[model samples]
Target chain A: MKTQKFLLTEQEMPRKWYNIMADMPTPMEPPLHPGTGQPCGPEDLAPIFPMNLIEQEVSTDRWIDIPEEILDRYAIWRPSPLFRARNLEKALDTPARIYFKNEGVSPAGSHKPNTALAQAYYNKVAGTKKITTETGAGQWGSSLAMCCAFFGIECKVFMVKISYNQKPYRRLMMETWGANCTASPSTETKAGRSILEKNPDSPGSLGMAISEAVEEAVSDENTKYALGSVLNHVMIHQSIIGLEAQKQMEMAGDYPDVIIGSAGGGSNFAGLAFPFARDKINGKEIDIIAVEPTSCPTMTRGPFAYDFGDTVQMTPLLPMHTLGHNFVPAPIHAGGLRYHGMSPIVSQLILDNIIRPEAIHQLETFKAGLTFARSEGYISAPECNHAVAMTIREALKAKEEGKEKVILFNWSGHGLVDMASYASYFKGELADHDLPQEQIDAALKDLETLPKPRQGGK
Target chain B: MSTFSTAPPSDDVQVRCPRLGHQVHFGYCRAENLGSPCFKALDCWYLQFDVVGYFKQTLSGADFAAAFVHQGRPKMQTLVDLIQQAKQGTPEEPSGPGKGSA
Candidate 1:
């Protein structure tokens, strides 16, 4: 019998988070200040984030210390278990050895707490009394709420009204953790009020919620806003995921040949891959794949014109850049897959060809999720399903080649809260919205005459 | 040809919204982008309900094509735009006086 689970003692937890910025082969450009169109500095971010976190955001120190206070909080869930997917291997009848770092075991039932605790601790240190944020699915909100409770800081979450009313469990979790959850468009701020006055029945949107949250944060000096993903600091805080996995894999006496993580704003994926990316930078040959949903196309395609019908059709053809609505696929059950952007760090890495980004279809992701749930006995969050789908694809490829490849992926979260998506899949309600290859090809042909999009500028 | 029911799921039925990255209801997806249905509404709600069929039945071909077919800038780009808009204390969504200007 082979060893199944690899556990790291609490003492073995990494003390510093890896910052890939210092190690990137080519440095990434800084985010531009929306108004000035110049590289944004710490002062630009000071309105919402604390000085400490902003320092981390701009720091390229390669290693940043995990504060003792944050370490104590992380100890409760740090050193999350790494397990070999022996069962999944048998189920797939593959020769590949699969390993997954279980992030679902965290308090918020996702990997979010890994950074939530760190962000909360930094806010506390900055003398912030309250934090304001917007939540789409409530994962980040609940995680921050729990961490804020531990730190005795007030948390105000402006959840989209639709989710506020429909998905009450995440809100309930936030309330249980002592955070004040408000439905956006609630007349709390001018932004919310403006939308509501226009349409009294507005269902509320993430954009609206963000406006409300940022308004509250900027208005009150003691209140700072926190984002769940898509920032360098957030990715830096999440690097602990991969750091621990490195140690656990050492114990298992195996090294992964391929690393896969589903990318949304890219924090969770970055958390697990940046450490390995460092090794790759130092001449280690490894396949680093960032999985994304086909629904949310990012870092995948450039501007192109697609005619509605066939390869020969030319009448209805329009440049996607001009129309602003070329092939935006339908939304998927995977919440992370819906995000239209990748983290700047991840985006830069893709540009450098250090990381490969692949888009998986909605139906295929769900199918992989079910296969994973049945064999691994843990249902994955829809976002995590993309990684599972890719992993299955890689494992099957290894089988076809008769190779015993080692594969590792981040099990970002459990799907207990997302069982409804699985239910829809079982009911045959899910569909794939990927455009046919011919349509895409025809669209590309038309792009040669169109105006080119500005690259890497605000 | 599809086996799934064309009837819409109850208003309470929620799926993880790809645009917002959270679970949202059919009610919101239908009209969240102001009075018009969200551009992704047909693509998103197709699974839970006969979203494409429903939209086809309710909207003219041009309107249906307009709502779901034409696309916008990437969400990442939109987010960057939102940050600028938010800094200027302007609402990014097209509501109120901001409608049509966007």
Candidate 2:
């Protein structure tokens, strides 16, 4: 009866991903090599990444064309539906029109495949035999595994230990797709061994997982490493989400007044909001929000600096919002949102004051997730609850202000696989974990121990 | 990946590789190590995977994005097997034990 779903045909999918690097207000600081303390060049990354992806990582081109092969694979699930949340609106009793891009329909059940397919396609073309990567909650690993299956490449996923146990389905999904999934801190890599030695009962962190994945990818000539979020290229591939939203919103005869998505490593939020962020940079009136959990408040409490991306100091120094890399996050149910850093692009945008980052507690996020699942009829992944909570917050604020507003967010994926989190929530086993300021300060203090960012290396 | 219980040099002991269950020296394979040892896989998935040696020496940062980082996918089969769908409970009601939120 009402205009509910805006659908796009395969042919209608955008051909090029929007790159925010070309439009950033401030030039980004180049990533530095760990050993040299100098800016890393393409050859330095040649070991772990194909040259094609390395180019995409550093490309400042406003629009980079998507390879036909990648687009063909994307046709399987591209042009995911954009829906106006009529039920959610009625439940909120607000005048705001809420819209969400459904990314759960992919084979991997998340926006991760948007890049996984792309990464797999490029590596396949590059004659790469396999990809090694890390996952916090298993979404990216399985997505990559499925992409590798389609492309006839091999995949290895190092899933964080806590999530490996919490979400059994995540590991099974990866294994079913033929990717090897393992628990971190298993004494497989030098990094993992060192960590296990120090704390035998360590619940592995994303930082440790990255170290393990990078070690394997770098040591093998035929394998390369792929990351799910927080990097320039991963976010670039995810632009398909936001680009599609732009066209879909026009079909609904509306544009978002405020845009939001949960930020773990920042890819999903970047995927659904960066295209709009481009419009905002060009003087469009829009509010872009990146939400994260209070348990691991990298953006809200972390500093904007050049920091290592992993714990064992095996990765390069990226300019991002970080609580120190050595800081281990509290084991929150939103396992995907449990990192110590934000994406470099996201950090730079916040520095330029273009994107607004918000932090929500675990219990409130669970409440928001439950609210949406009951009304909208789709369970959300725990990580996505952060955005849903913020969207509801914005909608209620609109009502209190007596103003009609358009609220948009990425319903990044469904939580059916993560029902364990909800089960824990219903059982009252999950609690809001707020990192005290003292811990945040101590973590930031650890950054002082690392080599500083290049003073003038623009 | 190997099952030969060779002792590791130094503190790095060879444990079962989480992916394939092979007895790999600590840190021998990243996916095997960085993965959740909080749980373990059944076998060593890639034991003789030897194209591994050809890749150039790993640069100090995995080239830079893989380290002192902060915290940070999905897929699946049908409705019944993966996980128990939230028992169809009302969101407002507290079913679990403990301090329920107001």
Candidate 3:
């Protein structure tokens, strides 16, 4: 009786990505220099990123035009379908209408390519021949690899070593796309070598891998670094997800009352929720939830302050919800969600109370994944399980309250290639690593040693 | 209830290893795939899954030896060569000098 799927034509795809910074309730705190404690400018970022992306990072413009070339390439997967999870709703038997923007349809099987394609295009235009990056679960690496293949640029990925050992096909996919992916703590770079020497069996955190990739990028003349998340430009490029969903929702004749997305470094969550967050900023009644893993509860447990984005303190200091730059979470199956820090923009939004963050356990998320797969016929990636789990929570809550609520979440990717994690789940081998309050307190104590941010971004 | 802090698997022979139908996650490492740390021979060349600590923890030394398959190119000094040098002792597990570390 109701529309089961909302589809958009390629021509209907948005030409401009939304910039939530323009409509934020308050201005963002400028990123600071670890050395000077002063605000960092373009020169501070030029060594690692192309000038085009740097511009977008600091951009206050409400909308930035997407280049036609990028749009042409995006047409291959752009205008991805929005599905009404009618089956999932029926399974839950709640009065909630569940919808998901299926980002798993992309070639890399994730929403990561939405920004990877844009980053590669900008770097190619800037005449950069090679890009170095870090991947947590290999989603970002594979997506960047595919984008680089289309642009004829070289891609080097430093994947977190645990993920390298856990998700091998994630490596195969990247290699097949013409990228070279190495495990972090390798002898390839100074940063990697030093970390390896310090603790050879170190499971290799995302922060450590980022330091290696950033070192590689800064050392080369023609090489630039690409990040999958936790940066402004990356999230800005990802806004296409929300923009398209807005159109699809209009077509479906319904608007979401609640928006949810899983937060890793926060781009996926910000991408789909920031547009609606704009409405919330303006007196609209909507609930925005950013779900995170209980194992690495940066959003729920960490403090908002200036911290290095990388473990080795090479990146400019961003005021974010950090679980200490050196702190590494246990090797959870959801590798992509293991970052110690979050995006500064998302951190600012959280500070302003524009969004709420909820932590979900690994076991609960896996259960939600299995439930959704059985009902919705799509196996969700482990990192994406957090959002799905939260969606189920809200749907059940609505049922308890006898209210019909519209629930929407970003289905960041599919878990078909990540079957090993699912296999572990089915076998009862996956352990839940809750962040002990003592560990959280120790990590916060580590942050107390760092230079405190100037109060008002002066 | 007090929480348990379990020792992480000595070598990353995670459950995914069997599911992927490979002994290790990145597959048998080749010279061309040195981009990965396991086969780097330069620093992380110790084939972790075949390390003595892991073998003693889960299975037998000879069993791990039999499962060890060499995949690197002929000219390249692979983990197979370095594992032989380590004497397969659990105490020497994490500190293997690898093969060609500078």
Candidate 4:
């Protein structure tokens, strides 16, 4: 019988996360302070994050040790299987050997828990009694909730009001994990109150939820805030995915020639690709692709520029990042890849030519999801579909080339919680939407007036 | 905000909101953020119809600029802004149920 899945014992799990900070061909520009316009120091972030994590955020170390307690907790789902997609290869009838690291087996049903658990543990040791975070689709919220339960820390999730109502099951999952989930703009904090005062019926947004969560964390001394992705520390924590993949690939007696993962805020892709990226940086021939929705196009279309972190232009300008200035938001079901900007680390890597970015349409991703489900019998999350879609594209390309290529991708999560998207796809309800060229041109004209970031500023 | 109704031709046209991750109507996207069209409305709805043209025809230049061109901040900036705002908390204490988590 063919060995379908590559397994690693708990003892084989990578103990230290591979940090890409020490490696970059060029050091990344530091995040600046909004008010001071100087590189933001630990004190600025200290208000919301623990000092330990803040240290991790700015650390240049190539390797960071995973705490034993965190490892003990990870034992529940650590060493996730690396599967050889024999069925998918057969279905495609391609010469490419396809493989996927299944991150869906985690308690939260996604790779999000990789960072969530680490954040929760750090917060717990930092004497934080509670952690506050905002979630759009409840993936991060539920993951944090479960980790907080494991760490005995109170988890308060300010979920976007629309998703809070639309995804009640996700909210229930948070509640079941002993986390308190509230509909954002729900009159809980001043931020929520201000929005409610303006529009009583306002279906809240992720921005509104972040405002509320940050407010709650600030008002309490014992509370700290957590962000699921797009931060350096989050990337550091997520490298475990790639580190483990490396060991499992060795066990399978094969190395991937191509590595793919979907990039929303770029953490999960960085999770699976950064360690492999080290190899690519050191003269190894590997194609690392970060797949994003065509609508968002943070890396694929947007030019490298300094842009304000928020729409309000309050945050300091982030350098070497693609401003999602011309977002055409094609209303794809891949909700996670919709973040306005790519992570600074991921952005810098792109600038240095260490990573490649690709964008695909909504229909292509959904179609690839269906093909994967039919072949592998595992329905993937809408976000995961982007990677699968890109993987299939590469496989077909290899077939046409008549080259025996090895491909690996991160199966970031399962789509069980996101069946509504599938229902929409099956019912032919999903449609493409894009911005008019005139509108994009008009918007870009105004963006010129904004402050440009200093190249590699101190 | 002018009362010129920026309603879509058909209220039935719907698309999944990238931000919210669910189906929302053209009506909802147009007036998503307290009477203003979502900043991403033009970006999200142009393919369905002449969304940019419709808004250009219906809205004042100021309103139009506010909606699409001046879309809100990125997620990180919002957190930084909130921390500053929370530090300068207004006198009013939050009147709500206690913290919800265990």
Candidate 5:
């Protein structure tokens, strides 16, 4: 195969930044800024968003109703399509029926907008003028920017510097939608200032960006903070994705034997799997797998404990599978999945053994991404490559077993912005790293020090 | 698609620029990468995402009347400057009176 380079020029933004926001319920406990030790409220987030959105962030039970007005706005991309990948099965020479929920059809080119729109809508309803957030690979930032634009809310994004430098087009998409995008650790925030004072050339991390964004939101009165993944409300908003997928599968007259999604902050995976989990709880026999990067294996390796979501304690301590808050993942192309912690809901499900977890190296994941791109004609994000790897492995297993297993997965986002990583991989330049057991053990020890939740209580 | 009449606005103030020497912007600053002069002194926070595009556009456009104009060497320097400025606030521009400046 001929090698291709996907480079962006000056005038074009990635197409993923044109999605709309939908209505979602508010979270119970909003994250607080670590430096100020103050809870981020609706007022702090107003500059970037409308006041109506601020009120929605705190509406706990608002998920019960799907407002007609909101539905009208979301009808453009609300119910994404699910496909049965018969061609993949034919290529693998397996009797297994394969399926995938295509999130790339959405304007943000990922399932992220399913929840971004909801968060933005809720924040706008609450009267917030702006929304502050952090992004690793720029999907979340682009998604939020699209949503904020639709709602006439201002968006301020603190993007991880590595991704900010690597994927300039992603940032452009945010800016095209009128978002004020900054690379973290920005001098605008104290956390950013402290990190810079320590290392003049520190490559910013997602945790650091989260700390900066949280600080900005908590300190301001007109802006309320918004997070893309890993909160009950976020997961709840994302549930719409799975709900729509279930209906699509039913329409196709197919039932999946296994479901797979990649785990980052866990919103996309949860959005694809949670509705299915509801069925499993009621005696549905389905296997669900959450894939993670072996470099930062929060599920297969990290310990289950209470840890601050951000490096600075600007966020609440949630009981989840975490590789210490201070853990800075090695620079990997799959920036979105390099988070040090998994979503609390995903952590709880893994603890209960209701879902399975697997980790793969970057090389293997990228190879799977290449194969899928050749067959499906859509280059998936490196983070979503984890899910593709697991799906391919499961399909191979079915081929060996000569069983007709039904496998389904979520193709989370397109990798047009990640062509550089693919260019490196095809040239056999991709390198993999294994965190030393000693470092893993030390992170585990830190996990032990966190306060445990009371028995049977969250 | 609008053609440049004279020069585009110079909102190219980065948090840190080697030429500017501070985190904040005061007046007409060259973009960290393209040297395309901007009238707005404050760092164009949006440029972080559009650097490649901006460089390509500036190099291709007829706006040679702008501030900085180099091919590739200063592009990386501009990125480095942006990173540095991002970490350290611009000394020239004040951190807008704690909200309500707009």
Candidate 6:
């Protein structure tokens, strides 16, 4: 298949990129080398993590406490607004009140900086020299690179091959941040070489990129791997978004009937829902829903089992909701949501039935995203559009039920980096790829290899 | 030392902690139904048990720091430790909640 690329004139460049990390609390855990298990020198992590993770624990009795110094340095486009979508409610002719926490204002244009700054900060403090990571849509990579530039850390990003080929401007953005960007499945590592040996022109998946990134970190003694999502610390760091939003909602004198977020490795969703989940656990009656692409329904369709988090299986087996380690999802425009497994914490919540999960098609999600962009003047990431679709559907149901409902969702990212996807959507050029049942079964079969529980409890 | 493939005819895989210089027999652990220990040295799991007890006991402050940092990498390990600590002696705590063999 011939790849389609978008060309943008200099004037077409986005006027601003918001850095929301400045206003958020830093994370507690610092960066350490995986192999050495030692605190990395600032120079050690300089290659991979160009920024540090600031630490802050969520407080039940008070609003989040963001340090002024960190905020001043990192908050280029922070204090993101929370909008009450009265017009959207009127369009639906429903009594449901819809509110959105807009994170599209940040540079790199997503909720990514919430952790990027924290990761960069920790790396800087640890004296690590650099950071290395993989990005699908380039938001996480660009966001990390931007944070690194701020901290004077070196950033290296292995972008997914297809996205790198299709989204040159995203690569350029990383370069603008002084990050060295390379397309995955390039001749950088043994893993990439092996994959390329099989299919020279294969459009790489996030799993493939993860393997490359891990390989880079494992091979290099100085560098540590920085994941954008899936880990607990990342979610913990991202909770500032939920913490702030919870405060902002209180300021608006409204409580959400339902909280929505799009899940890809589940960090953004957890970032928005964890605080509310705390409330729910403590007797708050609210619905928390996670929206994912049907193309990679790890929570909804996957088995809750112990599986290797990475394709190489170098990492320990984590018990989570997984579509198996080998499941390479069909390419969806919601590139961030195409991972094989959800975060362990998010998976546990879904397994325990604390949160509900729904999967949506790409076409419908993009349509909903377009509707939201036209209405609100901010284009959402394709992944974020899943929440938009779910919100619209719920609002319509509320109208039918004649019930006044309050809906709040995270506009986790902007689609400015996703103009190619929108162009495809407008030109009627996008199509959703559904994996064959045979392939899914093949992947599921690998789950049987996991170590099983003994016959009797000791 | 054998490495097991995800494919059929399952065998054993031996893994060594590069930092601790400890060798763990993954197959033996599976056969004996033992859970993987948390990487953090200060955690109860680390204090109470060892993956490879054959190592000479030399617990130092540096070792503790190393394990603590290693534990930070996998967020699940810390969470599992926290939850286990919270549920210790509580009726709600599952018997083997987060054990890999479970």
Cα RMSD over interface residues, candidate 2: 20.1
Compute the TM-score of each model's chain A versus the native chain A and list the values.
0.91, 0.89, 0.89, 0.94, 0.79, 0.76
Clashing pairs counted in every model: 7, 38, 0, 7, 62, 49
Model 5 Cα shift for residue A99 (angstroms): 0.7
Candidate order, lDDT descending = 4, 1, 3, 2, 5, 6
> Tens digit of lDDT per residue, candidate 3, span A83-188?
9999999999999999999999999998989999999999999999999887755777889999999999999998867668867888899999999999876888
Between candidates 3 and 6, the TM-score winner:
3
Docking class of 2: incorrect
lDDT of 6 by residue, B1-102 (tens): 112123322223332211111222333222211122223111211112242231124334443323222221233332233223222322111111111100
Residue-level error in angstroms, candidate 5, position A149: 1.6
Per-model DockQ against the true two-chain complex = 0.25, 0.04, 0.04, 0.26, 0.02, 0.02
Regions more than 4 Å wrong, model 2:
A159-167, A182-212, A307-317, A324-331, A433-458, B1-102
| Quality of candidate 3 docking, DockQ | 0.04
Residue A83 accuracy (lDDT) in model 2: 93
Among these predicted structures, which one has the highest DockQ? 4
Mark the regions of model 6 whose C-alpha exceeds 4 Å error after superposition.
A1-69, A160-162, A183-222, A308-316, A323-331, A431-458, B1-102
Q: After superposition, how far is residue A289 of candidate 3 from its true place, in Å?
A: 0.1
Better of 2 and 5 by TM-score: 2
Of the two candidates 1 and 4, the one with more favorable DockQ, higher being better, is 4
* Native contacts present in each candidate (fraction): 0.27, 0.05, 0.00, 0.32, 0.00, 0.00
Which scores higher on TM-score, 3 or 5? 3
Docking class of 3: incorrect
lDDT score, residue A119, model 5?
71
Candidate 3, residues B3-82: lDDT per residue as tens digits? 34233233334422211121233322211122223212111112222332432454455433322211111101112222
Worst 10 residues of 6 chain A by lDDT: A2-11
Scored by lDDT, the top model is: 4
Q: Tens digits of per-residue lDDT for model 6 on A1-458? A: 32111222223222222122221222122323333434434444233333333222111222334444346654576566678877677666888888888877678788888778777777776776777777755777888899888889888888866567766777899999999998876788776776677667655544456556655655565675676766555776677667667777776677999999998767788878887877775678989999987655667777766555443443444455766655544434555564445665666666545678988877889888877877767788767899999999889889999988889999888777666556667776455556557867897897788753221112
lDDT of 6: 0.59
**Local distance difference test scores for all models:** 0.75, 0.69, 0.71, 0.80, 0.59, 0.59
